[model samples]
Target chain A: MSRLTSVAGSTRAIRATHKTLSSPWATAGAIVIAALWTLPTFGLFLSSFRPAEDITTSGWWTFFAHPRVTLDNYAATLTATSGITVPQALINSLTITIPGALIPITVALLAAYALAWIDFPGRHLLFVAIFAMQIVPLQMLLVPLLRLYTGGLTVGGVAIFPGFAANSMSDGFAQVWLTHTMSALPLAIFMLHNSLSAIPTEIMEAARIDGAGHGRILRSIALPLAMPTVASYAIFQFLWVWNDLLVSTIFTTGKNAPVTKILADLAGMYGQQWHLLTAGTFLAIIVPLIVFFALQRFFVRGLLAGSTKG
Target chain B: MQAFFSWLASLPNIVQVPLVIAAFLVVVAVIIVLIEVAPRPGTAYTWVRAAIAIGFPVIALAVFGLEAGAAWVFGLGAVLGGGLFWLDARSTKGRGRLIQLALFVSPALLLLIVGLVYPTIKTIVAAFMDKTGNQFIGLDNFVWVFSAGGNGGLISLINTVVWVVVAPVAATGVGLIYALWVDRSRAEKLLKVLVFMPMSISLVGGSIIWKFFYDYRQGNQIGLLNQIVAWFGGEPVNWLQHYPLNMFLLIVILVWSQTGFAMVILSAAIKGVPVELVEAAQIDGASSARRFRHIIIPSIRPTIIVVWVTISITSLKVYDVIAVITAGQNSTSVLGYEMVRQFSLMPPQSGHSAALALLIFILVIPFIAYNARTLKRGN
Candidate 1:
C-alpha cells in the first residue's frame, strides 16, 4: 500500500512535468504544421473563386487586394461554353459514379460474408486468388477490356456483356461502370470481409437456430450492424470513381467522359480558361466532401474496422 | 501448333454465341460447387457441392465444346461468385438462395468479370504471345524489359525503383514527425484536416497546384518558388524538364498527398500509446526525446510497419501523378505509367508492358506478404 501510494505520487509528478515540457512545443508545432498544410488548400479555394485573369496575374493571396469576389470561374465552369461545360460533366460523373459505387459494395458484401462465415471447399485457395489479383496493375487490364468491349467476341458474333455495341452502342457511362467495378473489387472484398468476420459467430448461430434464416439474418442482423461500413465504402468508391481520370479516359470516349477527363481536356485548351479547371476541381470535390463529412462519424471506424480490432 | 489448336477446339460451342449466357450460368454453378466443397469437408453437403462443381464445367465443356471450355478463364470468376454465393447461402435459407445471391453479387460480378478479370487473363496470355496478340512469343517480351534504351522501355524499370524508394520513406518520415508534434495539441484536429486536405483534391488538381509552384520564367518569374528564388537573385529553372530533379519534384506531390494518410493512422497509434507508460518512463528519468523513442515509437511500431508497407505498395502502383504532372516524360517513367504508355496509351507494347507489370507484382509481393502477416499477427 505504501509502495502503491508512492507510485501514484510519482505518476502525478511525472504527468505535471510532462505537461510543463510538452504544452508549448506541441502547440507551436501543431500551429505551424497546420498552417503549412492548410495554406495550399486555402490557395486552391481562393483560386477557384477568383477570375481567370486575376489567377494568372497574381497569387491567390492577392484576393484581399481586389476587395471583391466574382463567380465568373464558377459560371464558366458550369455553363456550356466553347465546347466545354461543368454541369454536363457533373451529370456524366453522376451517371458513372452511382453505379460504379453501388456495384462493388453489393458484390463485396456478398463476398465478405462468405469469406468470413461460410464453410466451403477451396475457400482459402479462392481467397488467395482474390487477394492475388490485388497486385495486378489496373493499367495492364485496360487495353484488353477496351478490346473486349469494342471488338472482343467469345468466338461467334455474340457480343460480350460490356460490349458497347456491335456498331453504335459504344462510348458512354456504361463503359465507366464496367471499369470502376473491376478496380474496386479486390479492396472492397478485403474490407467487407474484415468487418463481417469481426461479427460474433454466436449471433449468427443464434439466428440460424431460431430459424431466422440466412437471408433474414443478413437483412436484420448483419446488414443493419454493418450499415456504417457499407456507407463508408460507398463513399470511398464514389470518390474514387468520381476522381478517376485514367480509367474513365480509357473506357469512355468523347462527350460521355466524366468530369476528371473533361478537366484534363480543359487543361489542354492552353490556359484559355484554366481557372475553370480550379473551379471544376472544387465543384468535383463537393460531392466527395458531402459523402465524407456527412458520414464522418463512420469514416474512421469504417476505414479501420476491417484492418484491426483491439 | 496442332495440340494448341486441339485445345482451342475443346473450349465449347457457347463460344460461337458470343454472349455465353448458358456458359455463364454453368460457370457460376461450377464456382459455387468449387467454393462449397473447398472449406468444410466435414459438412454433409460436401459431395453434392463437389459433384455440382465438377459436373457443370464438364457438362459445359461437353455440351458447348472445348472451344469455349476455358475454365481457367472462369476460374477467377467462379471463385469470386462462389465466395459470394457461399456467403449468401450461409446467411440465407429456403428457396430463394440463387435469386438473392444473384441480386446481391451479380450487379458487381457481371461487370467485374467482363471488365477486370477477363481482360487480366487476356493480357496475361497476350504477354506470352507476339505484339499482335497472335503467335506465342514465350520469354521474348520479358527479355525486352531488361534491354537497352528504346522508346523509354527499360528505363521505366529504373524510374519505378526510384519511386518505390523515395516516396514512401519521405512521406512516412514527414508524417511521423508531424504526428508526433501534433499529438496532444489544441490544434490537432485542424492540423490533421490541413494535412488530409490534399486527399480531397484529384490527381490532376494536385498536378496543377504543383505546376504553378514549379512554373518557370525566361528571366523574371511568376510562380511562387521561382519568384522566391528570383528574390534571392537565382535563375528560374524549368523544374519539370530536369532529369533526377524533375522526378524528385513529382515525388514531392505524392509524398504530400500521402503524408496525411500516414499521419492520421499513426496519430491513432500514437494516441493508443498508454499515458501510464509515458508517465512511468518520465519517472525513470527519461527525457522527452528518450520517452518518444523508447515509449511512443516502440508502441506504435506495428502501425508504422503497416503504414510503410501500405505506402510502398501504393508508391509502386502510382501512375496518375506522374502521368498528369510530367506525362512520364523528362525521364520520370515509372512502371504504372510506362505500362499504360507501352500497352495502351502509346503504340501498345503489349508483351513488354505485361512483363513490366508482372515485375511490379513480383516486387510488391514481399511487402504485401509482410503486411498480411503483420495484420494477422496484430489481430
Candidate 2:
C-alpha cells in the first residue's frame, strides 16, 4: 500500500512539472525575439515621423514624452528647389522594376518548359550549362558587358553588332531592363525548371493524347498549374528588383536613377537629416510591403510548393 | 508604310536590335499561320516539328536582314530548316526525312551558336587581350593577381576569404538555430516576417540605416547607436572606420539580410523531419536536446548543406554591403568591390579586374560542382 501511494505521488509531481515549465516560457521567448527583430525598423518608422530637431535631440522612443509630428520632411522631399522629386524618382523605379521583373519570368517560363517536358539531344547538357552560369558572379560581368555595350560588341571597333555601340548608348530605363533581364535569366530558369519538372509526366501525356500539341499543352496544362509558383517567383523577383540599389546604380545614371539610388544619395549628401532620410526610406518600402501583403497567400503556398515536394 | 518603316528604323539599333526583333516576330506569325493550315501531328511533334514550331524568331530575323549582321547566317538558315523536321519527328511522316532532320535542329542550333556560344568564346578571347583589346597580354593580368605587392592583390584576397568563411557559417548557424527554435512556436510566422523585413529594404536603404547606426563623431552623439552609448556613459566609436571588426560589421548586414532565406529553407526541412522519428526517439529515452541533435540534425543535414553552400556562393559575390558602407576603405576590400573599383573607377584596368573576377569564379566553381553532384545524387 505504501509503494502504490509513492508511485501515484511521483506521477502527479511529473505532470505538474510539465504543465508549469512548457507553455509560458516558449511563448515569452518567441515574443522577445520578435520584438528585438522588429525594433530597428520600428525605430526608423517613428524617427521618420518626428521633426529633424526632435530626432537629433532625442531618441525615437523619447517621442512618448513629447510627441511632435510633421510632414515637412516629406514635403521638402516632394517639392524641393533642387528639383528631383520623390514621386518622379518613384516613377523611374517602377519603369525599371516592371520590365525587369517581367522579361525574366517570360523567358524562363519558355526555357523551363523546353527543359522540363521537351526531350531533345543535348537537353541535359543545356540545363547543366545554364545552372553553372548561376555562380558566375554578377560583378564579374559588369565590365565586360559594359565594354561590349560601349564598343559595339567588337574587338577594336571591328563590329560584332554594328550600330550597337556602348558609348553611344545612354544611361536610362533601357539599361536597367537589359541588365536585370540578363542577370535574372539563369536563376529564373533554374527555379522554374525545378517547379516545372515536378509536374507529373502522365498529365502531360494525357494532354498530348487529347490532340494538344506542345504549345497547347504548355498553355492549357503546365502554365495554369505553374501559375502559383510563377506568381511567387514574380513577387520574389519584383521585390528584389524593387529593393536593388547596386544593379540600378551600375546600369543607370543621371535623372533616370531609381528611388534606391536617390535614397543612397540622400543619406550621403544629408547625413544630418535623419528625418528626411527615414521618410525617404519608408517611402521606398511602402510599395514592396503592399506587394508582400497582397501576394501573401500565393507567396506562402508557392514557397512550400517549389522547395519541399518534388 | 514608309512612315512605319522609318519609325521602326529609328527606334534603336537598326542592325542587331530592331531588325532581329522584326525578323523574329515575322517568323512567329508565319508559324501561327502554318499551325492553322497544316495538319497537327501526333506524339507532340518530333525534332523537326519542334524546330519549325519555334521558327518564327528566326524567320523574323532573316526577313528583316538582322541575320545579315551575324557571322552565323548559314546556321540561322539551318535552324529555320530544322522547323520542317518537326513534321518528321516520326519515321512514318511522308515529308523528306533528311529535310526533317536538318530543319528540326536548326533554330536551337542557330540561337545557341549566335546568342550564347559565340559571346562566351568572345569573352574568353577578350580576357586575354590588352587594354584596347588590340593584342594579347599572355596571362599578364592573371600573374598580377597572384603576385605579391600587386595592387588589390592581398587585401581583396584576405577580405574575400574572410567573407566566404565567416558570412556563410554565421548566417547559416544563426538561421538554423532560429528555425529550430521557432519551428514549433505560435509566433513562428511573425518571427519569420520580421526577419524577412530587412530583405524588403533595398540594399541601399539597409546601408543607410546601418550607416546611421555606425555614424561617427568626435564631439557629440547624434546617431541612434552612439546616443545609446552616451546614455550608458560610453564613448562613441567610428564603427565603419575600425579595421577587422568593420569587415565583420559589414558581414552582419549580409547575415541580417540572408538569415530569412536560410531560416525559410531550414524551417521547411525541419518540418519535413518525420514526426514518427521524434516519437521513436522519445520512447527510447532521448531528452529534447538529444532528440534535436539526433533526429532533427540528421534528417535536415542535406538542407543544412544546401543552405551553407548557397549562402557561401552568395558571399563570394558580396559587393553592395562593402561598397555602400566602407567603399573598400579601412582594408575592407573584397574581390567583387575591387573588380568594380579597378575597372570602372580606376582608369579602365580591365586585366586586373578580370583576374580578380577569375579568382572569384575559380573559388565558386568547386562549391557549385559539389552542389550539382549532390543534387544529382539526391534526385
Candidate 3:
C-alpha cells in the first residue's frame, strides 16, 4: 500500500513538473518556429490571390499594405490552353488515386487474412519476404516494370505474358493503377497482417468450431474488426497516390497526367510565372488538404503504424 | 435505352471516371462474392460460378475490343477460372482449407511475382547489358557511373552522400527539438499541424513554394529570403545557382517537408517514454537536461534511428524536388534524378540507369538490414 501511494505521489509530481516546464520562453520559441515553418507556404498561398503584376513585382508581404485579392490567377491556371489544364489533371488524379488505393487494399486484406489466420506451409517465409519487399526502393523496379508494361515478359525467347498495350487513356490509367497497387502491397499487407493477427485466436477457434468457413469468418468477423485499420491505410495510400509525382510523370501521357505532373511541368517551363504557378500549386494541394484535415486522425494512426513509403 | 447508351458514350472522359471506377469496384465485388459462395453445396451454384467466370473474360473482350491483348486475357481467365472450379469442387472433400488459402493469397502473390520480383531480377540483369539492353558489356556502365568529371556519377555520389548525411540529421534534430518543446503544451495540436501540413503537399508543390522563397530579383527583392538579406544590407543571392550552397539549399527543401514526418514519429516516441522513469530521475536530483539526455534519449533511441533511416531513404530517392527546382543543374545531380535522366535520354542508357538503380539498391540494403535486426530484437 505504501509503494502504491509512492507511485501515485511520483505521478502527481511529474504532472506538476510538466506544468512548470512550459515556461513563457518555451511558448515564444515555439511560436517563432511555427512562423518560420509556415511563412513560405503562407507567402505562396497569399501570392496566389494577388494580381499578376503585383505578384511578380512586389513581395507577398506587401499584400498586407495593399490588401488586394483576385481569382484571376486561378481562372487562368484552370483554363490554360498551351498545355494540360488544371481541371483535366484533377480528373486524372482522381482516376489514378481511387483505384490505386482500393485495388491494393482489397488484395492485401485477403493476403493479410490468410497470413494471419490460415494454417499454411511457408507462411512465415512468405510474410518475411513481403516485409523485405517493402524496402525494395521504387527506383529498382521502374525500368524493368516499364518494360513489362510496354513489352511482354519473355524467358528464353518465349513470351510468357503479353504486356499491357496502352492504346487508350484507360490503359494509361491501368498502368499507373497497377504500378501503385504493386508498390503499395508489401506495406499494406504488413500493416493489415499486424492488425488481423492480433485478433484473439480464441474467437477464431470458436467460430471455426461453429462450422464457419474462412470466407464467412473473414467477412463477418475479421473484416469488421480490421475496418478501422483498412480505413486508415486507405487514407494513407490515397494521399500517397495523390501526392505522387514520380510514378505519374513516368507513366502517364500528356492528357492523362495527374496534377502533380502538370504542376512540375509548369514550374519547369514557366518558373517566372508565379501567378499561374502559385494558383496551380494550390489547386493541386486542395484535395489532399481536405482529405488530410478531414481524416487527420486515421492518417496519423496509419503513419505511425507504417512509416515507410509505398 | 439506345439514346441513353449513346449519351453515356458521348459524356466527357472526366465524367466517365466515376462510372469506370464503379465498374471496377463491381468487378472486385463479384470476385469476392464468388470466393464466398463458390463452395456452397449446390451443383447449380457451381455451374453459375463457372459461367460467370468464363463470361467475365468474354465481357472484357467485348468491352475492350477484340484485340490480341484481349485474347491473352481470355485464355488466362479461362485457365484461372477452370482451376478455381476444380478447387471448389474438391474443397468439400476435406480440401477446403487449402482452397481457401489459395483463393485468399494467390492474387497478391501473383501480382508481386509479376510486378516486383520479376522486374527486380530483370533490372539486375539489365545492369550488365549495354545501352540497348541487348549486348553484355559488363562493368562498363558502372565505370561510367564512378568516372570522375564534371556532373559525372562521382559528383552525384558525393552529393547524395552529403544529402543522406546532412538532411536526415538536421531534420531529425529540428524535429526532436520541436517535439520536446511542444510536449504537453497548450496549442500543441495547432503547432503540430503547422509543421505537419507540408507532409500532405506534393514534393512538387513544396518545391514551388520554396522556389518562390529562393527567388532572386536583382532590383526590388520579392523573395522573402532575398528581402531579409536586403534588410541586413546584403546582396540578393541566387540561392539555387550557387554550387555547394545550391545542394544544401535543395536539402533544406527536403528538411522542411520531412521535419514534420520526423516530428510526428518522434513525438509519439517521446510520449511513449515512461513518465515514472523521469520522475524517478528527478527524485534522484537529475536536472532536466540530464534527464533528457540520459532517460528520454535512451528510451526513444530505437525510434529515432528508425525515423532517421526512413528519412535517409527518402533523401536518397529525392527526385521530384531536384527535378522541379534545379533539374539537376549546378552540380545538384543525385542518383535518383540521374537514373531517370539516363533512362529518358534519346538513346536511353538502360545499362547506366540500371547501374545507378543498383547502386541505390546497394546503399539501401544496410538500412534494411539494420531495420530487420532491430525489428527482431524488438520482437
Q: Using DockQ as the measure, which candidate wins?
A: 3
Ordering by TM-score = 3, 2, 1
**Candidate 1: where is the Cα deviation over 4 Å?**
A1-21, A66-68, A79-83, A156-162, A167-169, A269-272, A306-310, B1-117, B218-220, B344-347
Model 1 lDDT at residue B220: 44
Q: Please tell me how candidate 1 rates in CAPRI terms.
A: acceptable
Full candidate order by DockQ, most accurate first? 3, 1, 2
lDDT of each: 0.67, 0.67, 0.81
- The sequence of per-residue lDDT tens digits that candidate 2 reaches over residues A213-285 is 5556666788898887788889888988898776766666656677887777666566677877888888888
Candidate with the larger DockQ of 2 and 3: 3
lDDT of 3 by residue, B100-177 (tens): 566578779878997789878988998999998889998988888887852457778889999999999999999998
Model 1 reproduced share of reference interface contacts: 0.32
Model 2 C-alpha lDDT per residue in residues B202-247, reported as the tens digit of each score: 6777776676666666665546677788889998888877889899
Q: Which prediction has more favorable TM-score, 1 or 2?
A: 2
- Writing each residue's lDDT as its tens digit, candidate 3 over A125-199 gives 999999999777888889887877666555455444445553222334667888999999998999999889878
- Over 4 Å off, model 2: A1-29, A80-83, A154-160, A163-166, A300-309, B1-129, B218-220
